[model samples]
Target: MSSDFEPILMRNVGVAKAADLQVYEARGGYQGIRKALQMSPEELIDEVKKANLRGRGGAGFPAGMKWSFLPKERKVTYLCVNADESEPPTFNNRVLMESDPHQLLEGIMIAGYATRATVAYIYMRGEFTEPFHILQRALNQAYAAGYFGKKILGSDFSMECYIHRGAGAYVCGEETGLIESLEGKRGWPRIKPPFPAVAGLFAKPTVVNNVETLCCLPHIVLRGAAWFTAIGPQGSFGPKLFCVSGPVNRPGCFEESMNITVKDLIYGSKFAQGMIGNKAVKGVFPGGLSMGVLTGDELEMRMDFDSPRKFGLLGLGTAALVVFNEDTDIRDVLLNVTRFYAMESCGQCTQCREGTGWMYKIAQRISLGAGRREDLDILVETTRNMGMMPGLSICGLPDGAAFPIRTLVEKFRAEFEQHIVRQEPGKVERVLRVLN
Candidate 1:
């Protein structure tokens, strides 16, 4: 499963004293910014655009395209680094921050220069106590070396970086929500039309990028766009850091090209290796928990930004895979997932607040053996009517809630029906036929 491709973002991860500034500099760290300093802001943006680097956050929007959204002439453009890696089991960001904090800082410097942002803020999750301290130490090292303050690396472009710890709200992972929390307000997502690119972080033009996305900047700056696009399939460019959890022999983050299939990821020698005790995989949340589930039979799909759409998932969300074994109960998984979304909702949108709660309640009843045959239908219908797809919620939290519950119920309909307790004689038969 090991390809000829070398690690870019993760090159310095396992080295001794990897987080040290001298170690990073010795490995050609600040060269990207040095090269970037010579280029105009337009050139920097164009270079990233040519690389086809998409945001590694849930959305997978093109990073360069996002940077280009800023107004042509803004006096105070801000770059908000989304370090709030709140997605469940998605600690690749935390790893990057802790293991290679300098890489992240260099990326921020490059991106800030590209966007002409005078200030950059790393919005960290409150739970990232260790990473926050490690990154703060690294920031101090960078500032002392003149890489963060004015005239970085002896260049005219100057940007200041700061770490803003959040209250660990899952909603703050959203760009607008992060901005709201940064501005000392509740972490509720603002509606679009005045999108973050136009008005963000105190009503100024802003660009919010995820930790992993920024980490790719230094590599793209040094390697060129053609080098990145050559690694993975078209539109799924660059080397990707994948977080694989659950009952796997090697359950942790691994970096590889996007050419790897979901099957390869689970069973590949260089990746997760195989399931624990050789147990059969019942299902996998190939992306994050919210991106929906892939039945065991669906493991042939590739792990890419585009592949999941064909299989009815939300998208390649954080590229974090959580696998479950055959002995596990899909109903319980749904209940747990629904309960999380229901609790994490910002309560800004009626659909998300009410829909997630109702879904969780129905899932709870199903898990508790009190489920009605019609409960399954109600869950599916509720998901369909809520979220951005139905234009019902302010943010995509409802959409996130909908994907897993809907996919689990739709794909594992029989399992859900079997849990209905056979309260009525003909009810189980009717439930089985609902999909037919």
Candidate 2:
């Protein structure tokens, strides 16, 4: 539990005392926001652009690029911080919010100033009750210090933020879905012809960013973009918080430079304990279940935005690493993830609504000892087709749910085949429990 006084989001959490307004100020916190107030909005955006910080939520879209998309005219822009960390096995955002509330608050204020957003919203997940209160307290502190509300820091610029709790739908994590929830509507994603930058909440220009993504803004402004860019691997800039779980002995979150390899992270002491039961490492879901699977041999590949791209996988989604060992069953893993998508699908898009359910049923049948050998091919083909379907889908919900299935089937075909051949009753129950 002992570690150095690293300023990474999770660095001082659980070991040293939590950072409060006084402690944060003593440690050079809020310096970014203070520095940001001195720069023009365009200058702040330019600084972020130079940092090359892509969104940390699932998609790796550039943060400054998204900000630049906002209309240049003086309209009421909005900055919505997506704190709904609902992606399965992803808990990095939660750590950031709970441990370093001031950092997030500072980031939001800076972002609001840059975007000229009159109002900001932190869309917290329903389960994040504790973090919600923590953030609420931080917001109160920020306002008390004149960091929020009218004429922030005695400048003409002004920004106000409110916390909106989601109703526990995974779809709400999608940017548009989060918007809909903020608008007091059902948490369903809206079409994107008029992207959020153009027409968003209350039909105003909005910039939706992840908690971790926004949290990095203050650091980028305080340290300069070059320093942030130079820390991580090429293209993948700044320190990344990887939430490693599953059978690892130390199943917790770690914030490290992107230079760390997947092997180093898996074996790093930051995790809960290493791998459980001395089980041989089988494979890893590098960026949660949404990104495609990586076998043990691929462990040497550095965990970065581009490294996984070479293998037809993405590194930015959720920033969660779920490791599986030899004793873990691939079928059970597929079933578990499929059911999650099936339950979370908003049913707005016919393809995602029906396809996710179909995939779940097939996975359930196979895991229940009722599947045939040919069912494997059906699962693979269904996932492939689902990935091609078109709709008003604002996010990759369909693809997120299908990518793992397709990868698992392709990489662990023999294991899936074994499930059908054995038809063990005990195995069926175990797989179902894991899926649930």
Candidate 3:
């Protein structure tokens, strides 16, 4: 099925002759920012709220709600754009940062204006060095053009943005971690009572938004909320950029309507090229490792925030759609993902620090052919308990790290059982070395 999908964030990427300012302005770029400058800050926030745009950085929290959390009376609120796309199999944000830095800049400007923020910062992963340069150049251009700095677009609204690069910790993708890193401190999550909005970034009221979340702001401002809402599903409004990777014939990002079924996305003419190696798809990690795996049966489900929730999985996690063919080992995949969370955990939260490591061990054992059937139950129980741990720990790192273990045990029980039944003598030792 040939797709009629037009790329939004990545529309002129690589194809445009010039990636500089002149080319972007000619193609209707910065119009959103120009329009946003005309509206009152409150009106802009209302528009975004009416659009029903949700955060695209794993958690599906409403973008408007997050912005609304800002204390209106505060004079120095900050909008931190999270560009640290550390989630495995998630590359959608990179597309925006690399291809169309202006889109995100425009979004940041709008978000800053809405929240009465005079300064915005783009906290980017260090690995995105190239994109970082691209964005920095874009910000300079915007400043020169009067889109940034005092009296932006001659509207008395001043916003200045700077790019801060992270040292490549997955935890830094978390809002609090990003804040801590931005403050030049150890990237650890702070305990939340004073959520970022109440007290954040030097203890001032602030709003942290993901890159994609901020990128949607300009569109919301330009088209109006109703128009944006009319494009996608009822609850999930606007177009979504779905990144497909791992063993697909055509592995890349594609923008599509939210309600598109997983089957149509993976097998459609515009994506995947009909599965890897012509093998039957055994499972899919629809929203990266944190969201857990959905088997072939669930792949037919719609690709929306609530669709996977109905199957007991979270679907809005980076919108990463990783396809695993029959040749893939579920145990191995789970083990790798578990190990990642374990290594990345900041050790501030006991449940996350300990539970992630423990889960990784069990998953590694199973992948090495030494898993006992009871171990599967233990993995599930431990993860369930850990996920229930108390304290509103800064960031969802604890819960995010634990969900995969719980979901994997529940969704792929047979795979774990097979590992145990086919245990080979001394295979555990070999697997341990490999895992290490």
Candidate 4:
């Protein structure tokens, strides 16, 4: 995997005053919006459709198709920029919002025009207090520069932009859930059928796109769909920001194409720069805590929307890699992931509300040496009983909860069983030592 690729989104991240409007302009900022304002909104949407830019916010949905879902007869259209990057071990959106606020705003403006939206709200997570301030200043700058207010860039199209800080609820990352929070209510996911495009934020036709998804718009408009599609394979095009953390030697965000493999990310000098301590790798949580772990042998799996499925892992979720060395315990890994999904459930659906807690406690018992042989059976079967099936829960929270535990228990069943295997006291002691 050797090629020359430049960073598009993060090109200005390291420059001093990069967050400043002048610095971003010196680097060719807002050129897309200028071009976009000259073209019809349908033209912008068609370019995105041709580019095949999928949503970077875990779901991998097509951006253009999502925008097209809006009804043609709606009175008002809204664009909610989902800056709530609450997924564990994922913070790439914060860098975009804090370092290059105008770029995000430009994307918003481009998307606003495409969706025929009159207002845009940036639903930033409360934990992103600093980014919030940075984005607010950028919004002010953009408005003062005639880039965000009425007749943006001297065009007839105008869209208002604002930011609302969420109380750091993970559920708000879901589009409709973020919509509810924006309406000054609890961040609970709304049932679909009147999907966001049909009925969203304040019951207006709304489009909820992730911060990264919107950030790509400026580039798509300026560089054209041909340039965008040339970056990666069909269906998974464009630059991706991967946040590699958890015991890596160089834990930082690296921008790369979607074609990069997990092995390359962990070992490539331009990426994580290999694992810390030179220890053997036991397992890897390839994408934050939602997409389940990939065993050390599965490192060769391609980092894309479809490749991970061959290994019983969910799609490249948030592209946040949490690596664990061979010294780590499998039971402990399951416990931590199970506990996260459990704590984050919004308690909207009965099955998700209770099943998440059940899964967490079961994994905890396994980690604490209180698990029995039947507990493994209980764990596997419990996943099915949960309301993780589509339409059961208000959103994908339950499925997000069930998928990781189901895959973890199923894939690592043998290793999990060894913890409860009681041969002789001496044998169990030796096993524990080897595991540790």
Which candidate gets the maximum lDDT versus the true structure? 1
C-alpha lDDT of all candidate models, in order? 0.89, 0.82, 0.81, 0.85
Tens-place lDDT digits, model 1, residues 131-155: 9999999999999989988888777
Taking all chains together, the TM-score of candidate 4 against the true structure is 0.95
Q: What TM-scores do the predictions have?
A: 0.96, 0.93, 0.94, 0.95
Q: How many clashes show up in model 2?
A: 7
Ordered by lDDT, highest first, the candidates read: 1, 4, 2, 3
Q: What is the C-alpha RMSD of each candidate to the true structure, in Å?
A: 3.7, 3.7, 2.3, 3.7
Candidate 3: residue 162 Cα off by (Å): 0.7
Positional deviation of residue 272's Cα in model 2 after best superposition, in angstroms: 5.4
User: lDDT at 172 for candidate 4?
Assistant: 91
**How far does residue 32 in candidate 1 sit from its true spot (Å)?**
0.5
Tens digit per residue, CA lDDT, model 3, 310-398: 87775568888888888878888788888998899888867778888898888777876777777888887777766424443446776
Residue 219 displacement (Å), model 2:
1.2
What lDDT tens digits, residue by residue, belong to model 2 across residues 152-218?
Answer: 9889999888998888898898888889999999888887769999998889999999999988988
RMSD of candidate 4 to true structure, Å: 3.7
What C-alpha lDDT does candidate 3 achieve relative to the native structure? 0.81
Question: Pairs clashing in candidate 4?
Answer: none
